[model samples]
Target: MAGVGLVHQGRTRQYEVKVTAYVLFSCFVAAMGGLLFGYDLGITGGVTSMDPFLIKFFPSVYKQMKLEKAHENGPYCRFNNELLTLFTSSLYLAALVASLFASNTTRILGRKTSMFLGGLFFLVGALLNGFAVNVAMLIIGRLLLGFGVGYSNQSVPVYLSEMAPPNIRGALNMGFQMMITIGIFFANLINYLTAAQENGWRYSLGMGAVPALLLCIASLFLGDTPNSMIERGEYGRAKIILHKIRGTQDVDDEFQDLIDVIEVARQVAHPWRNITQPKYRPQLTLCSFIPFFQQLTGINVIMFYAPVLFQSLGFGDDASLMSAVIAVAVNVMATMVSILSVDKFGRRVLFLEGGTQMLLCQVAVGTLIALKFGVKGEGSFTKSEADLLLLFICLFVAAFAWSWGPLSWLVPSEICPLEVRSAGQSINVAVNMLFTFGIAQVFLPMLCYLKFGLFFFFAGFLVMMTIFVALLLPETKNVPIEEMNSVWNSHWFWTKFVPQEVVSDHSSSNCKPSP
Candidate 1:
C-alpha cells in the first residue's frame, strides 16, 4: 500500500488517513470520562451551598453560613469547616491513590476496559451518594466516585490521542476537555433547577449516573486502540483496526510505526522505571509539571466552589447558583473554541494567550473584591460590583477553558512514546488529583485568611506557568505520536537531553517493516 510521506523536523514519515465516522464515534464515547469528572467538579460546589444538603450533612457549616448572612463579618470563612471541605477533597485523595493502580489496568486490560471500570464505579458511587443516610455513606460514595475518576482520567486522553490522526489529534484530544466543560455546565444547571427542592442535592448527586451509564454502554462498543492491541501482541487485529479507523487499506506505514514503538515498549519490563531514564526526561518533566501547574492555576477553586464564591461576594443563594450556571456556560463555549482552533493555532499560542488573559482577569477580580469588601471580609458588594465580579470570573474561566484546562490533558497524552504512555498518563492524573485535593480542602480557609488576596496568589501561579511554557515547552502542533522524540531534539533546551543520535535511531527504526 502506498502512503503519503511528509517531513517534520527533518524526519520523514508516511501515514495516509481521513477522519471517519467510526473514529469520531469512538473518540466521543471515550471523552465521556471527562464528563464524569466535570460533573463531580461542578456538582459539589452547588450541593454544598444548598440549604437542605448542608443542613443535613454539614449542620455546622449551615449554621456558620446563616450566621455570616445575618452579620457581614468573616463571610469568606463561613464554609471553612474541616469536615465540610473533606467531603469535597476526599474524592481527589482517593483518585490520587487509584490513579497509580489504574496505570496497570490501562496497560493490561486495555483503555476500553479501564473506561468501563470507571463508569461502573461512578454509577455505583452516584447511586450511593444519592441514597446516603449519613456522613459515612456520603464519604464512602465519594471515594468510589474518585476511583472512577482516577481510572477514566488516566486512560481517556491516551485513548483519544491513540485513536486520532496526527493532523487532528489535538482537536480530538480536546474532546475530553470539551466534555468536561459540558459536564460542568449541566451540573450547574441541574443544581440551579433543584436548589429549591427538598432533596435537590440528592438529585444533583444522582444525575451523575446518567453520563456514567452512557460511557459504560459506549465503552462496550468501542475498540481498543491499535497501539494497545499491538502492545498486547494482537498484531493482525491491530492492523485491521488501523485500516478501519484510517478509512483506508493503505495503512502499512502507520502499522509498521506502531509495531516499532511496541517492540521498544516490550523491552522495558517496567514502564515506570523506563520513563525515568535520561532519554525520557522531557516527557517525564512535562507529565509531572503540566498537571501540577494546571491545578495551581486555581481553576478548580472556581469550578468546585463557584456558587460559594459568588454567595460570599453578596449574591443570594438562587443568584449564586444562576451565576455558577452562567460561568460554566462560558466555560463550555470557550472549550468549543479550543476544539475548533487547537489543531489550527497550535498548543503554545493558546497557552500564552489564555494565560495572559486569565492573569489579568484574576488581578481585576482581586482588585474589585478588595475595593468593595475590604480584605477583612466585613463589607459586601453592591449589585453592580457583584455583577462585575461575576463577569470577570467568567472571563477567567473562559481563558482557562481554551488553554490550560484542555492543553494540560492533550499535551501530556500525546508527547509520551508508547513505551511510557500509560505510566506518564498515570503520573499526570495523580499529580492533577493531588493538587486538586489540596486546593479543594484548603481553598475555603485560604479564602478566609487571604480574602481578596487569594486571587493574587493564583495569579502568581499563572505567571510562573506561562513563563515555564515560554521558556521550556516546545510546540507539539502536528507531530506524530510515535515520532515525538524529534520535537524534543529540535528544541534548544530539550535537545540537550535528547541526543541527535537517539532521535535519528528512533526515526530510522520506525521505517523498518514489522516482523
Candidate 2:
C-alpha cells in the first residue's frame, strides 16, 4: 500500500508538469508555420533586386530567358519595378486562393496532415523558386509557396488554440505571430549578409525549405487535435492522446469536455454558414477585419520594397540593403519584447500602445519625406536627413512588430468560439491575403504619384483602428475561449460586477457555461 501510494503521488506530479509542457511543446511546433510565412516575405525582397541576371543562376530550362538589356541608351533605363512587386504579390495571391479552401482542408485532412502538406509544398516550391530561370517559373513557385504559407497560417493557430490550456492560449497563439516576425527578420539578415555574393539571393530564397522540412518531420510526432479526432469518430484514440498531452490520469472530465465541444461543433452546421448567421456575425466581423487592418497598415509595402524605398532616400545599393537589414533587426528585437509582454501586459494595452507609437513614428517619417523628397532639388534627402528618415522607419517597423503583428492573430483566435473557429479563421486569413495583394499592387503607383500622402493615408487607418479597439475590443488574456462570446455579448452586464479586465476566471465554479 505504501509503495502504491508513492507511485500515485509521483504520477500526479508528472501529470501536473506535463500539462503545461505539452501545450508549450505544441506551440513550438506550430510556430514553424509562422517561420515559413516570414521566410517567404524576407526572401522576395532580396531576390527581386537581382531579377535580370537571376536566370543565369538557374537550370537550363529556367536560364534561357533574360531581361532585354537596352543598348547605349542605358541598358534597362526603366526598371520593371512594377513587375517585381507583382512577383512579390503573387505569393499573397496564391494565399488568397488557398485560404478559401484552408478551412475545408483542415476539416478533411486534420491539422497535422494539413500542416504536413503545407510543408511539402514549401519544400517543393522553395526548390523550384531557387532554380527558376524565367518569370513564369518564379511566379509558379511563389504560388506553391503561398499555398504552403496560407495553409500553415490558417491551421497552426487553430492547432495551438485547441491544444493549449485555457489560461495560456493567448500567449501561445501570440507566439505564432512572433515566430513570423522573427522568421522574416532572420531571412532578411541572411539576404543582407549574402547580397554582394554570387547566388546569394538564390540561397536566401531556398532557405524557406528548412522550416518546411522541420515542420514535415515534426508533424509525424504530434498527435492530431482531440477535437478533430473525436469529430472524425476516433474517440478512443483522442481520449488517449488527450491523456498523454494534458497529463491527466483519470481523463474523465477532459474527455467529457472534448465530447461536448465536438458535439457542439457537429451541430453548428457547415462552419462557413455559421459565419453569416446572427449569432456569429460579430465574431466574424472581428476576425475578418482585424487581419485586414493589420495588412492595410502598409507594412508589407515596407517589407517588399524597402530596398527601393531606401534608394529613393539617396542611399546607394549597398547602403540601401544595409538599412533594410537594420530595419529587419529592429523588427526582430521588438517581437521578442512583445513575446515577453504579451501575457503580462494584456492584449488591449499592447495594441493601444503599439498603435499609438506607430502613429507617431509614421507621422515623423512622412513629415521627413515631405520636407526632403517632395520638393525636387538634388532629387534626395541629405545624408544626415537620410539617416533620420531611416531611424523613423525602423521605429515604425519595431512598433508594428511589437503590437499589430502578434495581436491581430491572437485576438481573432480568442474572439471566435470553437464551433466556428475554422471558418472564422479562414475568412480572416482570406482578408489578410486580399489586403496584402491589394496593397502590393497599388502602393508603388501611390508612392510614385501621391508620394508622402500615402503615409497620411495609412496613418488615418491606424487612427480608426485605435478607436475601434478602444470602444469595442475586449481584453481576452487568461479567458476561457468558450466563454468569450458570452462575455463579449454581455460585457456591459459583467462590467457592473466583475472588473472590466477580468473576462472569465477558470478557477471559479460560476465560470461554467450557462444552460
lDDT of 2 by residue, 377-454 (tens): 124667888889888888889888889988888888767767788888888888988898888777766765567777
Error of 2 at 175 (Å): 2.0
Candidate lDDT scores, in order, read 0.90, 0.73
Mark the 10 consecutive residues where model 1 has the least summed lDDT: 1-10
Q: Using Cα atoms with residue i matched to residue i, what is each candidate's TM-score against the true structure?
A: 0.96, 0.86
Which residue pairs clash within candidate 1?
none
Cα TM-score of candidate 2: 0.86
Model 2 lowest lDDT segment of ten: 1-10
Q: What is the lDDT of candidate 1?
A: 0.90
TM-score of 1: 0.96
Q: State residue 386's C-alpha deviation in candidate 2, in Å.
A: 2.5
Q: Compare the candidates by lDDT and give the number of the best one.
A: 1
